[model samples]
Target chain A: MNEYYNSAYKPLLAIDCVIFGYEQGELKVLLTRRKQDPYKGAWGLATGFLHFGESLHYAAERVLKKQTGLDRIYMDQLSTFGEVDRDPEARVISLVYYALIKVESQTLETLEKNQAQWFSITALPKLMFDHETMIQMSWGKLRRKSRYQPIGFELLPEKFTLPELQSLYEAIHQKQFDKRNFRKKILATGLLKKLDEKQKGVSKKGAYYYVFEEGKYDELISQGFNFELKSMAFGS
Target chain B: MNEYYNSAYKPLLAIDCVIFGYEQGELKVLLTRRKQDPYKGAWGLATGFLHFGESLHYAAERVLKKQTGLDRIYMDQLSTFGEVDRDPEARVISLVYYALIKVESQTLETLEKNQAQWFSITALPKLMFDHETMIQMSWGKLRRKSRYQPIGFELLPEKFTLPELQSLYEAIHQKQFDKRNFRKKILATGLLKKLDEKQKGVSKKGAYYYVFEEGKYDELISQGFNFELKSMAFGS
Candidate 1:
């Protein structure tokens, strides 16, 4: 550390990650049981201290990767929560981040093997030291972001039916929307390209699949579109 | 600070504030000239170091209060920037915040006494390390937020005409809009309540004044109205 760095008394910096995944018509967060004292054995967000010569983004990504056993997750800085005495043992100011990952069967196995388990956002276990608040806020961000812009698409397979897309939105907003209005509102966005292919296994007369059009989304964004989902029947 | 707080090799925490004010139909940011070096005399955002036991919010407020001499302002966290060696002197991570303030003449004088001046976002002077990037990102946040919600209204007086309101929007988006369509779109939100009063000094036929209805705004928000200023007209 430089002399200037060492001159002042500093606060211990840390990162806490809230990993969200959409699975089986639900939004879930990954929690790992704390192995040590203070909040020993309690469910909590995957945590790591910022190491020397590491950027905050790198530290956060490293933490998420370690816990999820997967690389290149869609992670972002949700916000920083520095409540002075947030950490009981230390005066730590944490840069809290949230990651959205797709939970396929293979990835789910990878997570379980790494000692992390997915808990539904609504039915979370007792969390340690403000971790619950962190998770709640992360869910709030996801909900708000999904409303204003398109997300949760990453959790979907490349081709998914309108029903699957609606289920993802319902899981995020925690509300059952009217099927007719949901379909109308989503189609109005012009960002979802309808595919000719249909689901094979579920039924004889299968529903058509759709894929999110990234180029069209970007084009609409440049025109000041917020991906705003408005006037839709949220729950019927 | 507690003993546990002092138990680690911690990094110094700091905050930089980007104070935005709208004047003469242009968006401006408050800048102060540095009295000391590495970038001595360069223009920079109002900044302060986070002290022990002080939350990041409090530290940011103190910094803004010092610069603008305003007791209350609409301030929110923009994001955290920590690229290990960002500061040449130390490993410092800054929590940057942006604030929106009404620039009335009374408050403007207080800012001058504090040796801070407002610069148009488009014509900013060379800034200190990473301050420019911080300002740009803050602007991006503000633009996105204003598009999704009604924010520039804080920069307006208690009452104003549609032209005045439109001017504020233009300043924020940095683009002119078609007046007829802008009026039609704004009135449709029902967020604005028109007053019978009109400006006496401006012209013989003055425009009708209007005020934002907070109660209606809140009601609409609860109904999932995003305060979204969607497409009406961008440049004429």
Candidate 2:
């Protein structure tokens, strides 16, 4: 590496994972206590220094799995933060990615309690460094992705109700939506197949259950059909 | 600076700028020759190594100035590329930014041929090392940003004809639009102040010149109007 390049200036690059999980009908983000010199004992996004031989995607996945004991989750690169002093110790450039996980089934209860926990985004504590700005950016990306892609399915179980999907969108968007228009737009996408089931625990109405039709969504996308769910117009 | 932190694995970060300029009624991107080893003869995005203690924004702005000989242009961070072998010479991560420069004036002719040249996007050569992908991504961002913001004015002169503005849109979107509808939508925005002067070179009708009202556009955004130039229908 030295023979091929200049060795004078080298900045440390790290990868941070903003894992968003929907559990018990609320949107939550995973955080952990930093046990090092900078921001010691303060809650921050789960992060790790990148290994030399691995790719960014692999590093992000490794951090997610090591922290939560989960694998094969959906993650997307969000943005890179390179403020000179974002890290108090060094010029560390952090590439942030967001992960969507269904927390009800993948919860690691035995993970280091002093180091890790899921916090409701609405009631999050004051974070260290620029972690709060990263979360806000990830939240905005998630909201935009939810409307443009069938990502709401990533936050729910294998089977879910229309109301569950609507509620998830509302939570991510932080607004109310008209139920009829919401259902109309979502079902019109033709990407959800009604399952012969009902979510029995919550409602007497037993809202109809549905599963995301992966094949149909891909096929429709290939044919140029857009998946859009318009939020209820604000202050209308 | 190296008391507690290990400095063994730091990699040099570089900034590659995708400078966009509109000229000859087409969208253009600035490219440079790789002056050093790696791909010495191949054309690539204008780039330079990040200097110590300089923020990414400052490095990007500096590179833009070095290549274009222009200042205070429309610049934005697109994304960062960090594949281990992306540089071929070292583990170099490139922070890419997209910019808009006024090209119709003599400013573009003064560009140093040794460092940069503006190429029409459609006739661009095979770029070096994931640069083609970077250009495509930046182009997509440019299109989306144009629709949601008033940045499209950056590409036009201080005063331009309606046909010129339409041509700029067509060049970016790569599609033909209904002239009447385009005129109606733009005039409805009330953000274009018509000038008493007319462009005499084009037609007998002598298209009127217009100036973009940045203040009016900003006020309208605060009043809840979105800047949308794309067709609402599938094939309209």
Candidate 3:
């Protein structure tokens, strides 16, 4: 029995995360430089081998916390990468996860110590192995999800100006939307609460700050109200 | 080195398929009864252990073929289920996949020999080992994907009527769409070819037959056309 069990084929299970954060009208992905061999010193998605008796989600969260020093981040399993040669070291099946992290909420010291850095999605560095493909797939999923879900809220501060929200959407979809149309459609959803205070700086006429009303959003979702934004062309 | 490798912890990897088919105005999922000791004689998703050095997608396809005698089906990796106690027998991590197959295209002999059967999505049996959760998650993903992609076409016959297409959508979303609006919206996309044929069996006044034009759909998709049907309420 021991010999039979030992002879059975076993492949290493792993997890990789595409950590996305939005800031300054740009979409960024957090990446870490490989500190070990095979692709040492090369940038890649934060990844680790899944341990025994652990759930995939738990393993993903562990990797996220260990790499970014962020806990309770919003993450979803993007897809599994099981190409024959995805990892050169051994037969490794990677369950890739995409995480949305508020850029301001992360600790900079942890990133600096681990040689972790955020790069613009448009100008990503050469990633080791199939990490680049994972990032591209995550970006595609994010763009599609953002159209129907208010996932952009995960990447923003607790309270943000209307322009900041709009910029985040524009950065995500990689296109400009009509201001009036965008505001009218988004406001109709009733998922944002206009705060009493106005955001100072960045404009002579400060824009009003708005907070995402999770309770209202959940209520609307329960009632089957879908969130959709028209895919307006550039300069629309 | 061999002793060390053999002594290391290893978890069993498995693949489960949510095989979806549309027939008789209903969405159906293919299931099989477990023949082995664990959950013996209980209905569950068609599943198999993943072999060493095999890709996850390949494992899913192999399971589909072994259980249904189907090949080259439209399948997508839904997500990985890796809860520690998901499988009571062992530490099993299941990679779940959803497959779309035309009911008529399948070989029924293999299904009968394997004791595999199709159950309506609305009325499923007590599935074994977290299989119910897998089916529900796959259904959710299918409904969402069908909204923006012509995925339901995979479940229908090559030549179908307008009403048939409408029924497929209704069955998937579990709601009725406005006939006029659904037809108008679907036709405007130019993804269906109206054939000179008519389907007379379903109604006295036969509906005109239409075929999904895959090439046209692909072209439209490349040109940034999104497939969407308004989620009309029931009895609309």
Candidate 4:
């Protein structure tokens, strides 16, 4: 709306979100069918053009809400993609962001109305434009961040069993962790609070649910402690 | 320039480089004095507008070469700054990049010709626009990245003493590390090639000079090894 610079070249600005969600012990990404030409009906990351006078993060949040009908999810800027001809119809420079959402938060009816679906990272469909590249980069960010930060918790429910937490890590990293070793390393951080309540129907001996203690995690980080679970024994 | 999308709004695109260099046991950043009216004479990161059809990395490289007269340096995209009022003269979106260069590689004559100077991170001048925020963000990124990657080598000479390497890490992280512990952890990685030569200037007992084994570092990284130096004791 503001023509602040009349003579400078302006490239079209846009934002694309790689929204990750975990369900049934698998990591999945939310995608929407393109409604316009240039790739009509093709699946792609949830994306939208940036509105004038809006911050980049706000644009990403708006796009995520528009596509998934969910708000207040954990989101991070992955990187910016400006490959000149990345868009077939225009020279649109896009800022790619990754979001982690709880799968149960979105209703099936909303997803149907928006023509949105979740695809496992390993089995993604042919995406329009350079979206496949964006998804791959987002997956790398998630895997790297999950090792040092409790970012995987965003994909799981607030209260989760140790097994569920380990499953989420395995899904992101694409490698199974030794069950006993995983629990030991994670619990040793003293960042998880074990709830007296137990998860039902997951196992015959229901595993006790746990919640991440964000305050304690931050405090530990301030005191020169890093959260690293990468050394846990890897399973074949 | 190709006018592919005449109807869409195009924000001005630009790239800014936070070029970091190390010299005499201190870390410094390359800065230029603005020549135009918006922030004339103010110190800021070297930056330039993106040319039509130029990729983001190319534009950043061009800017780096132009300001510091250095090419093919180790650079990475720090982040994009798209705040609506980030630039007072125009609605410009900046893709900020951080570059690590060996200080001795640049000539003083070239720096004088470009009116660029290196400033210590601890004592930076008043920068124009939101360049200060960009520098702060870049420092955080450098610190975080230095912990998990062997990026500190980018700021050091090809053959460096163990104390020089430790000093570079100390400057970036703003903390002191235990001498014995730091040397043990770094040596155990086997990514440093201990040279047969010794450096005699700074200490009564000359220290051994070493060079980073980049090939081995990459090989180890490909095999799922992380380069971590955070475990060394930190000082108050």
True contacts kept of 3: 0.43
> What order do candidates take by lDDT, descending?
4, 3, 1, 2
Weakest 10 consecutive residues, lDDT, candidate 4 chain A?
A1-10
Q: In model 3, which runs have C-alpha deviations exceeding 4 angstroms? A: A1-8, A231-236, B1-9, B231-236
State the local distance difference test value for candidate 4: 0.86
Record all residue pairs in model 3 with backbone atoms less than 3 Å apart, i.e. clashing.
none
Q: In CAPRI terms, where does candidate 3 land?
A: acceptable
The complex in candidate 1 yields a DockQ of 0.48
lDDT of 2 at A37: 68
For candidate 1, what is the TM-score? Answer: 0.90
lDDT of 1: 0.83
How far in Å is the alpha carbon of B71 misplaced in model 3? 1.6
What DockQ would candidate 3 receive versus the native complex? 0.47
- Residue A204 Cα positional deviation in candidate 4, in Å, after optimal superposition: 2.5
Off by over 4 Å in 2: A1-4, A108-114, A231-236, B1-4, B105-109, B222-225, B232-234
Full ranking by DockQ:
2, 4, 1, 3
True contacts kept of each: 0.57, 0.53, 0.43, 0.62
Candidate 1 Cα errors over 4 Å, as ranges: A1-7, A105-109, A184-197, A213-226, A233-236, B1-9, B105-109, B219-224, B233-236
Candidate that would win on TM-score = 4
CAPRI tier for the interface of model 4: medium
lDDT over C-alpha atoms for residue A90 of model 1:
74
